[model samples]
Target: MSCLPVCTQRMKELAKERELEHGKRIEWNDWVADNLVVQFEKLVFPRRSQLPRASAVPHWEYSCQRLNHAFVRDEYSQLTLIPSVRENELVLQFHDFETMGQKSDGEIIFLDDITQAQALPSQDSVLHLLPAADEPQSAGYFCRFAIRDRSNANAACITPLNSGLLSRQDRWKRPRYAPSKPIVIDLSPRDLGLAEGFSQAEFDIIAGLGFDSEQDMSWRTRYPTATIYDESPPSVLSHMRRGKLLPPQDVKAGVPKVLIFSETGPLVIGGGEDPYFDLPLLNIINELNASEDDFDFLVSIQPAGILHPQCLPSFAKAVLELLKKRNSVHVFSVRLPDHGISNSQTYIVLLASPICSDVPWPATHLDTKSIEEQICHLKSKNPRADDTHPTAGKHVFLNPAGQVNVYNHGTGQLPDATDRPYFKTVDFESNIILPTLYSDHGWLHPTRHDILTVRECARIQGFPDDYIFYGADKALRSQIIASFPPPIARGIAEAIRKIIKEHTAPGLDASTFAALNLGGRPQKRTRVD
Candidate 1:
């Protein structure tokens, strides 16, 4: 018998005391020596020696409460049979035994057909009876085991344990953390260019957008039916196949019920920004309409990218081409300057003008006034269309030298190098200047120089204050926001909801669908005045 350190110390102490009392130390066979050993063993291994109670840990009911809604399963709780120590009992050890058998002449004798039979209650086996933490002491103190005949499990002598049950009222106790309410966006619709009616009161007014991640993981869980279609690191097909995020379906099943694209059809399907007008996705939609069952779904796209400024009108044309009901296709985007026209037009003027001249550009056949005057008129017509200012914080810089330094307001332009709080984004070779969100910096706060923080970018995109983004870096979070602005998405969704409701209802005229002004492609705007 090996003694613990404390036990060894006490044994030596006892020997020394006995030597003082007697001529020599006490013998091992002596009654006093045996009593000391037993006392030491008791001290080494002490137990609370109390009856098991439900309060030891939260009962199985509490474990169930830890589960998400409709996520309750057996993994929450477990149970296992741990054999207690018994004296001189014959325990047969079978390492490779799986069949039901009995011992006979140093060999195993199988009863009945043993080919399909299996051994139950293996040493490592655990039964998940309830979703609760395992308590070894509870089994030791409260459970009682009875031997049952292997041949007849139905006639087993085991008795039920009734102590685990709690009162009926206790079963409905609240969980440690309550579930949050779903976000609801109520929208008030109006004519085009008039969305600003609610801008002051309803829509969040913030500057800049960011995109760091492709998929918003929260959206997958929050809105399971909403599927994001993008071509990137994780292909749309691969993303849809990931379990729980999308419904299990074959590739031939065609498009999902609700597909959301952060960018327009051309950007996603391929092709660069020079001529940002294409219809690969729209063509697919047109083909899908050939069969009634093929495209019975709603497709929403937000084409607010600088490259595809005309995405709304382009998508509108596609919807117009649809032979079937065009109301199912919707485009949700902010009105911005068309880069194809805006950037090229500005670049042309910059090249034509004399660098030393006070005037910007010469007048053309289109306008009677100078090119600068024409530009000013266009700017006044589209007041909020200037995309050049990196930050929303605007300033008028006046220099006595009058050195002409023009910035492309159509594309994002950084402040001068000498300016305080200045930051320069990495350049892209494909384009002379970076597009709306591709640039490195944004003006989010009224007075800040560094790139927009993730929180500020989220605020600009109309994400709720409480909404949390899942990502490792600011780049990933920025990407997600730039691609999908919740405010714009909500507007489109609201429009779709109304269109769907009206489309399905009886006595609704086909002409009314066109009158909604939410569907169909749009043409270039004529001068209002």
Candidate 2:
């Protein structure tokens, strides 16, 4: 097994005697085995007497949780079809089974209908057909089989075929690893292609994982998606589909709802640097909130990727609840699959930037719960926006080589203090960088670092703490976070609410807000200042 070396090292640490006490030494395969190709479900397990300890093999869920942002740019072509393992399932099988030591002529063999086949579990067929001393495991052996009857599916018979043979004169058909471009096959159901059934973001991820074996199997060779300029991922993750259609929980069918992104956390700055300009974000939100009485929901998403999944949910829920209790606003989090929030029906988006860090930080969740707590401890070191909460830590402001003016929250101020301790900052997993420099943060002088806390990022974008991102990669988390439209920025619903209040009941005015009065598209925001 690929993980054997790691297992061996771990076993030694446990001591031979310590493992013996567990009853018996068992071998388990989690990673791919020495034989490169496999249809794993058919692989047999060892006797229960030699079964491995539950904790010895890693959990698939935990394995997924540790995935980093080592993302391939994107796979623009090809689709995936997960074949079922049910008795009624039909699958493709190929073989060169002539135990008489025969070679195949390089001619291709094709079979159209695969419905008559019954599968032979490796348990009943594997040991009988071992690879020869020189044959590689990837030269797998497969054959078509069918059950005699539904009642006798427990037993099966092999089917006749003009078998594929690589004779002494011709070589076996060598499968190409990379297809410089998408391999377009003439499969049926091309007309049944997905319509509006899948969202853009969900589809991209699915295509990424499926094409690796066929698309990115080599080093050196290049594909367009692997290039930086080509970022559109071609995969679609379908487990995100839903069986039920439920109405949104936080608002009435007629009321205006508002989603906010409010994170603006910061890092240590060096001497005389310009502070970041974070005022426009907050101003936009407050303006919209103040403009209407028809608004029913007030959602806030928190920063995520580092803290537990609750960062988004916790931020959303807290903000929503607080709004509800204080002003009768309703709020909720966007549900996701396998703990990931979905983009479907997500009406607004938040976009925020975290405060510059004095040191380096990682976005890994290897020890998420514990590591997050340590990062939270850093809040005690500075005069943060929410000083009572004590957020992100370990920063010393250096004297900026230059400086500028910046504004944020309710008041605009100059943050010119970088001359303190040498701002040494670090995140839960990132390596070290001294601090960040700023471009428009009120001043021209640069800080020792780049940007802010995940939560602060949430705050700037108006994502309520309750909305969660299904990731541990900071950049992915950021992209998902920023793609949203902050309810405050839109302001259309509320402005319409005011016109409705003076002119009608329940909903808003149609004269100007609705399409009845005039135009094609709604008015667009032309200025940010």
Candidate 3:
């Protein structure tokens, strides 16, 4: 495997890891190719006389690595883009690659001419950026290539086409047309890749992609679509205290939310595994304070020791001070006089989740009650999705169903990924206890069991199923499952933030702000025993 060694070595170098961190597994990489080109490029063409066989359109993908950095402090990210067939117009499809896996990046239809087209096509999606198994720094970059020449035994030489140059005639056609006399470009680069980690030069190179000076003005253009924001002011708790909220906010400027997800702790499959789950969240909070992108009307979410009630007021004060220089942005914290909420407008979203789904489910084999009877209330109001599915539920709609989850799928940064959690396996036999249900809808708790399955829990927490986790053992599994705050809760907080901003901003109607886009396919409900 000459190709394998090179590919493997190159990927490692890019990630900047000298050796594989303990428990880290490479997921897989995906290759993108055009279907029409695959047919035309073939030597044994179906005889014009032989009717085209009824079959799926030919398409292709190349294998990539899947690394579930379930416990790595520093994370790696990759972005892929595959454009559909079109004329000279520069239409681009984008994807965020935080996870590892062979994703279907979409088709790469070739065009004949550039000058021939009258208008650019609207964003015809291939796939949205999935969340990697790991979370990535908010400040990052991505690139994409069209897969070419997969037919060769040596797949290393495959290259992508530069859309900047194309002829006009090949842009469009009827059902009868095909790739006539044509040209092709190599999509893959000759070398695997060079250098590791971001430097000044590397950073600049990645940043320059689609460099547009006018992007600032277009950042948040006025659109007919109403914005979604968190309506309640943020709840800032101290980690030392580790509890709930004091009260509410009138303006609801900002609230610090703390999320507690159970995990197997840290693992070092190799020498030792090292992943700081809360690092990215912390970094983002710091950024919100330094910037003035209407970022104020939102409360910062963080990881307070045991819970969010313990979040420090010092952080809020510091953030407010940072915005002192900016004329528009200003976020402040509200103090409570007593035990209840300080004000009715205060918002506190306590996102608590188990590390996995080992929660002892009573009916390992269905008998009296249907699976719908096993549905998790915390996941959805619907009780029939997971347990009584097929009859009551159409598809799983527990927590995550966003274009954003695709961007974060497989790299193992996230603690509460749907497919894989931070800790997959935990020594149930080794632990001090056996399986038992912890709460109300309780059947038999799987140790990691709460109200939802792993995916169901992830969705409610705002993570797509494709997002992978780390920790392959039961102890680790439980840890990852319980460590995260629910995504639904986060989405709620996000909505609340936006609502507060709209109300505070002059002329913006409070009624309009209430119409935030937070709808999704509802989960089905079934009666459980």
Candidate 4:
């Protein structure tokens, strides 16, 4: 084999070791050459049919290093391939050089027109130049590549070269024909009627604080359709919080085509003196009216606050009434069993659209009784009782009244009969899990006789095990308890997607239509030839 002088030294050492182990002479040079050929073929052959032709190639980088070895082989020296754009075509220049500063002849590959010499499969190879692996367990080389489109400099796709063909089954696809710009307004307590003793200015300042990094990340993952704006000045949130309408220029720039207002908490109707029970809703509505930038659709999810017969109009009912006045509205109820209080709770979801005269409500049926029976069966089998989980196998004592026995750990004794007020144990066979699972006097595990862990509570709320929670244990527990179930949310999302698909005009993009109807401003319709 004609090996580079630098590579010969390392190959000689390896050859000597192998010969000694086999107790025979070996033609190491020929073996190395054959191995290199096999490796090159494996890397280059599979992708021969996939490469696009006559297209402007984006900037990309490919690198390979010797696997499980500190030193790189002479043939595996870094090769920098840079592509320059010429006449809207990609011109890739390939350069090979040694670390010792010796440069070899260079080659240029024209994407639009490849020469006969450059058209060879071996010449077209980029990853195959790396050394071949000797064993199944060991990779001959580790490869990495990145591609960045010139039009979107900030966006880049990076992946392992040996990742093979990735499956698209797990990819999340947005709703087709939906609005291009959708905004989510997460209302706080102050945004509604409950101020918790804070003044209006103070409440606005706190509401304007916006989400933290973790929250921002979680929200983006949860609501892929919603547009999350930067918290910087002159943002949509800033203008909305200050009770100011978006300027015409801003509206024309990227007006929100869909608006989702979310509020989840225990609110009371006529509980406070504030006449405007839904200040945030009113503010947004007023702003849109002033700007004339009506959203294509609006969705609201809010708790059915403490009901009062004398309150006249509850927040949920009032909001529904207001929405119906402006556009076609569909309403749905989401029921949640509050195990902590042994009561059934309900929340309202409203979907409103301007262009569509009638919208179909998303059908959702959750059988709490059936779900409870399944939970009971699983608990009887103790499926989750394993050493891996924190709450597994832990025991708690419950009284006949279904209250947990609060043992005083300091004294190592049970509290006196009078001191131990009966507390309810969570009835997996009857009641659904509630957010108050973290409360000291709240429900205990139906079978385990212990407080429910964050993950256990989250699972009961229809959250996947992989969904991450950030913060202290207490905070995580609270978040899991307070969240709206994912199953119901998904059903609602699917319904909205269907509505968009049915209502949108064919061949016209949603964003283009939105721009044309900006602020309800009338534009002369010109016929295109």
TM-scores for the candidates: 0.29, 0.17, 0.21, 0.43
Q: Encode model 1's per-residue lDDT on 400-485: one tens digit a residue.
A: 13534322122122343322222333221212222222222333222232343444344333444444444433443345333433
Residue 244 C-alpha lDDT in model 2:
25
Ranking by TM-score: 4, 1, 3, 2
After superposing candidate 3, which stretches have Cα over 4 Å from the reference? 1-294, 306-453, 456-529
Better of 3 and 4 by TM-score: 4
Give Cα-based local distance difference scores for all models.
0.27, 0.24, 0.23, 0.37
Question: Model 2 misses residue 45 by how many Å?
Answer: 72
**TM-score of the candidate numbered 4?**
0.43
Candidate whose TM-score is highest:
4
Task: Summing lDDT over every window of 10 consecutive residues in candidate 1, give the lowest-scoring window.
Answer: 347-356
**Candidate 1 deviant stretches above 4 angstroms:** 1-218, 221-258, 264-280, 290-299, 302-317, 324-333, 336-438, 444-449, 503-529
lDDT of 2: 0.24
Clashes of each: 18, 99, 139, 4
Overlapping backbone residue pairs in candidate 1 total 18
Candidate 4 deviant stretches above 4 angstroms? 1-209, 213-256, 269-279, 306-325, 337-343, 364-366, 369-423, 431-441, 510-529
- Per lDDT, the best of the predicted structures is 4
List model 3 lDDT by residue over 1-529, tens digit each: 3699987777657444412321232200000012212322331112122223343344342222232212111222222213233322222221211111223333222222111222112222122121111223333222222222222221111111222211342111111111111110101101001000011111111111111223211111211121212111121212101334222122212111111211112212222123332332343334433322222122222222212212223333333342231211111111111111111111111211101001111111112221222222222323453554533432233343333332211111223222222223322232111121111111222342422344433332223344443322233223322332223223333333333333233443434333431111111244232
Q: Model 2, 277-373: lDDT tens per residue?
A: 2232233334333332222223223222102221323333332323322222112122111111111111211211011001111111222122223
